[model samples]
Target chain A: MDDRPGAPRQNASEEIEALITLMAKLPGLGPRSARRAVLHLVKKRALLMTPLADAMHNVAASARECLVCGNISGAEVCHICRNEKRATGEICVVEDVADLWAMERAQVFGGRYHVLGGTLSALDSIGPEDLRIPKLVQRVADEGVSEVILALGATVDGQTTAHYIADALEGTGARLTSLAQGVPIGGELDYLDDGTITAALRARRSF
Target chain B: MDDRPGAPRQNASEEIEALITLMAKLPGLGPRSARRAVLHLVKKRALLMTPLADAMHNVAASARECLVCGNISGAEVCHICRNEKRATGEICVVEDVADLWAMERAQVFGGRYHVLGGTLSALDSIGPEDLRIPKLVQRVADEGVSEVILALGATVDGQTTAHYIADALEGTGARLTSLAQGVPIGGELDYLDDGTITAALRARRSF
Candidate 1:
């Protein structure tokens, strides 16, 4: 019941507790799971903990957001932003660096990317100035981009951000498009959301 | 589908991927959650990642299994094993160090512990020799322990290990006892399994 900051949680050692608290701060992890992870790591200190710490420290010291695209990169600009072959007059806009990486994992996109960092959210008070919207607009104008594909989430914030960007780039001669919203590959109708089912029906194509 | 060791994983950087791969090796984490955790860590390198890495490295170097009881501790012998006040003529045996910590969190037992490291499993080729069984026996004999408590799991292997230890400790004049099986605190009867209900009924206490 002690709610004071840094209160001891009956952990064995201060070092272990500190490590567990930090691990708990990570996304998708809570105190119990963090403790479990720290125990697992400690049990395999030589085989896993040391190497993981070394790798995390190296990344913490070296990883930087790409200066141009806002993607996480070791260099000032990411390889995708620097690669000339990817400058095919098409640019994909994603809400987060994770999304950009997901797109890359698909290996279907050969164009450049602009990471929005996060979508606009009125509830959260996040506006155009809060995100990389200005930078994205500047990139579209300067890179001779012909198409700006919004590969954002299907959430309300994502749709609003896409609309805002489309409006901002009006008359810039760059075709504004968003990713088609339909049932995902391997998706089942039973598990699909109502919005998705409606969108799939609206955007249906000839088989 | 490429199962090659250290195969590239389409990550933005090798350092990031290495950290994620190590994280994925944790007990409850998967590749997706590891990537999410790494991304969250990278985003807060200054606030969380660097300190977590430092803590992990320190624990990796300093945290050693207690020479006597196999409990993880900063020193060669854990604080619990060396403490003079906790010699309550009782020793609780647990399957893992996590179980030891859980017992400590309960703060009810004023005794020592013997971490088994793992239960005896014929399927996994693990025997009592692989655990700290001989050490427990030596401690019981040298320390004049009056009672040995088994706070192990309810599973088949846990029962088998407890029975094996009980058989080994016979004729030593020490009382052998295992943790009681019953409905957990705040447990609903509807969710109770048949075996647990049966055990609770057999071990019923007068109201």
Candidate 2:
């Protein structure tokens, strides 16, 4: 009974312990996994750990948020914003940089992106001014954007923010569209929630 | 579908791409998780990413394997090897540094450790010389050790290494013991493997 695998230990060196502590604060890693990861990193120093350290150092020194779209980049303007080929007069709005990256991975949207950082939260006292909403409005007018895609989440805050943006861009004369809600790919209708089923039913289309 | 998540994109900056590539190479992480982790790191650069980078740099610069027992530390001799209080006559031999760290977490073993790096693998052509077995033998003879506990796995390679160590230490006058095999706490007999069930039966105690 004394051999619990993940009990905290004070025997590790200060740097290793510190590294594990920081690593455990990451999104999916816990303390036990952090310990295992640190061990792996140290054992493969030449192949992985050192390179990762160098990469992080470089990023910490050079990485910046794009002044135009709020995407992260090494330059003031992100590559997507600077790329002339992607200047298709369309802007996709997302809540965070992770969502922007996810959209990029899909490669479905061939235009630029605007990261709002987070949605407006009344409880948190967040307003449109706190986000990049004003910048987005300005971008729509200045860039002659033809379409504005609101790819926000289905949460209350996300919807509230989407409606607020729609109102703000009312006079900008840009067409606005939000992603459709329904059963996801490979999802079974029987297992779907009532709300999704209703949305899917309402949004039914002809083949 | 043109929406493959991991299709290589030239949009990401070189350093960020490099970091994600290395992170994906970790034992428990994949491309998607690595991308998420990198995005998290970039967003929290001031608090988490900077500190993690510094800690990695420090550990990479100073961490060294213990000359005596193979434990990792900032010093030539690890803290466990240097600690006078833990100089018990017992030595626990393990397959890797992670296992050594796991034992330290248990805090029950008041003895030092010998990390074998890996178990014997005939298919991989791993002989005794590939491990720290020779150093362990020397330590047993020179340190006046009383017992050598084999805290290795019950896998074929683990058993093979344990038996090989035992044969090598036949005349070393140290008591040899392997970890006991039995039903684990909170385990069900129905779900237990045949080998484990047989071992548990053979080692059953009478009330």
- Write down the TM-score for model 2: 0.91
Q: Which ranges of candidate 1 are over 4 A from the true structure?
A: A1-9, B1-9
Candidate 2 lDDT, B29-138, residue by residue in tens: 77778888998898888898889888998888888899998988889999888989889999999999889987887678999999999999999999999999999999
lDDT over C-alpha atoms for residue A126 of model 2: 97
**Each predicted complex: what DockQ?**
0.65, 0.54
Residue A132 in candidate 1, Cα distance off native in Å:
0.8
DockQ of 1: 0.65
- RMSD (Å) per prediction: 2.0, 3.0
Of the candidates shown, which would achieve the greatest DockQ relative to the real structure? 1
Which residue pairs does candidate 2 place in steric collision? none
